[model samples]
Target: MLRTTLVAAMLLATTPAFAQPEPARVEVNGMHMYYEVSGEGPPLIVLHGAYMNIETMGAIIPALAESHTVYALELQGHGRTTDIDRPITYQNLADDVAGFMEAVGIGKASVFGYSMGANAGLQMVIRHPEKVDRAVLASVAYDAKGWQPEFLAFLPQLAPEFFVGTPVEDEYRRLAANPEGFPALVDKLIALEHEPLAWEADVAKIETPILIVQGDADTPSPEHAVAMLRLLGGGTMGDMGAPLPASRLAILPGTSHTALMNQPELLKALIGPFLRGETPKGMFD
Candidate 1:
């Protein structure tokens, strides 16, 4: 009996400290939302790019979980969440996200998203600002015009074949209820991207402080990003006598959209302060 107890202790001590429990599933708005909640501070919600799910941000989520109750979710039709016939619109997705928060009992949280997730984050701020404390919108624009001509042209090129044998497909198949429906999900996102989407006027209504993260060569030109800031009362020249705009913008040099998600350490360093309601100094470099 003593030897058995000693063996169990050895096994327990060797287990990794940072290992997170498996995601828990909850039904919200008729969709099964699979989310992993970790850490024990203020809540931070994470949304991933289109055609991808929570795992796409895998590298970054753990670091964020260090100081936050990271509510990383698989949106409807993404990852383990089965799709409904309602179609995949940003507005509907935002509603789903809002409902998820209510079901999980989170009041207001620091919402952060990348690519499709970023767009969804903006939609959340628009449709459900009451539930959002701070927001991070990365690698996205407010409307069709915000995306550059070349990037706009690149949307149709995102065929299912492009993701075959990649991590995106592997992760999708691993957790998706219907792995065969991956192509259809890709089609829906492409069609949505092609459709004329405009919300620049809505930007003025978003009173929530937002941190805009974009790569210098991202799909939306830096000028378009600046325009977003202007609407958020950021681009105007405020004197040292006054407070800086609640909205903060970061345009990382030599960074591409693909490179952005891959650099969790860099993102953590830059975003840590903003999440805490502090301005990040010298992020342009």
Candidate 2:
């Protein structure tokens, strides 16, 4: 999927007007994390994908900013944030997110995370439920097995040299506090991809409302998305007298994991109402 993301990043030329908000740095989880705050209203933290930064999020940040105060972050080893000794596991990243919220004075906030960010957000909702009001997890999977076979096959072959001439490498060198650490960062992330993780039971117990978004042709299998929805109290026949589930699922057509970031209008239309607790109106309702 990193290949898909590389192509998408290369295609992304027009940066959003709100993309360059002055970033603030804070010490969170023993790392100097860089984040930018924009818009107004309730706090909403936007997390970027693997090897991505806030600027790579495209127009989605401004779209979300229209309603919520968007706090876009560059996680460990990415963007302006320098690397630490710790491995890039979801659990560690989730803890970093919780610590960041506390440092920023946001007791509870909604989360919008994509790709690796989404997986970390899932862990956050499971491990630190009290800190998250709700979440939007895009292209997320419960375990490594949830990914498509092709994507799984591509992981072991991933190397830093694969990104040398790509935008991901270019952006890393352009914004990283330690630009030379790009190879190390890529190595750690590849290790993360190989790490085992399964949270079905944990996900089933989460009380926080969640919206699972994925593309029909994304890395995470469609079956896995549906299974995750079921775990989140979704996948019910609401029109048949069953109550609406606290969580929801959205599968965007003609979109890939990388292309999902480019769909600002579609994402805003779905995420805005969900975060505001506005349920969709049906004929039966």
Candidate 3:
């Protein structure tokens, strides 16, 4: 019923000269994945950040749907997707995304990932390069250690109950009940760490075109974005030296972690042309 409603909404919106609708719910590895597909060009898969659902990408969807077949997924334990029985890890999440693509009959698709989803996107590209044609890593970090300090300082004050095994939804509700609980939620997220991947080594293996987008105010610093670009841009090394793929890094002015939601024009300015295979003019280039 949910799938039907979304598809009907999309069709109604598209018929009067909007984008075309291509909606369905696909089951992969015993998990039901909800996705809304639109438009009719090259496939583009969108992955949202941690603690966010597919709806979080709503702000940027319409623009991308203009020219590409956009597939926005709700990661495990987010939105309508059921939680995994085992503890979640980046690799597991990446595999789930890859399985989803295969189940949907997508041979190769461009991936767009935001925040935690961006990290997962990197894992997918590294672990299953053949499935990805291109990628966009938005507000991502290559290292988890660099993020610990900020998370430590903020956790204790927010939702202490999360430490006692509260479900994610309950924790969110508790935080919502007391706005001050937000910090604790961040701490819990930071505390739940995954084994770090040797990003430099893994990035060197990526041969697909990539676009790295970061906001001026993204946490842990803008230097992270620069690091990603250098790693993926081949740096001083030539083509033979662990050669990086074709990529571009765009740092939007006065933006933050939620740049896609808050700055649609800028988001479109960077992504629209890139999906179309046209070079983004000026700063985006």
For residues 164-189, what per-residue lDDT tens digits would candidate 2 score against the true structure? 77767777899988878988988888
What lDDT tens digits, residue by residue, belong to model 3 across residues 31-109?
6776778766899998876655554455577677777888988776555565544445567778999999889899999
Error of 2 at 194 (Å): 0.4
Give the per-residue lDDT digits (tens) of candidate 1, residues 161-248.
7655665566668878988877777666656666557887788888999999988977778998899998998976555556688998
Q: Report model 2's TM-score to 2 decimal places.
A: 0.94
Clashing pairs in 3: 158-184, 159-184
TM-score of each model, paired residue for residue = 0.87, 0.94, 0.75
Which candidate do you rate higher for TM-score, 1 or 3? 1
Please give the CA lDDT of all the candidate structures: 0.76, 0.85, 0.64
User: What pairs collide in candidate 1?
Assistant: none
Candidate 2 — which pairs collide? none
Whole-model alpha-carbon lDDT for candidate 1: 0.76
RMSD in angstroms, all models?
10.1, 1.9, 8.6
Which candidate order results from sorting by lDDT in descending order?
A: 2, 1, 3
Best by lDDT: 2
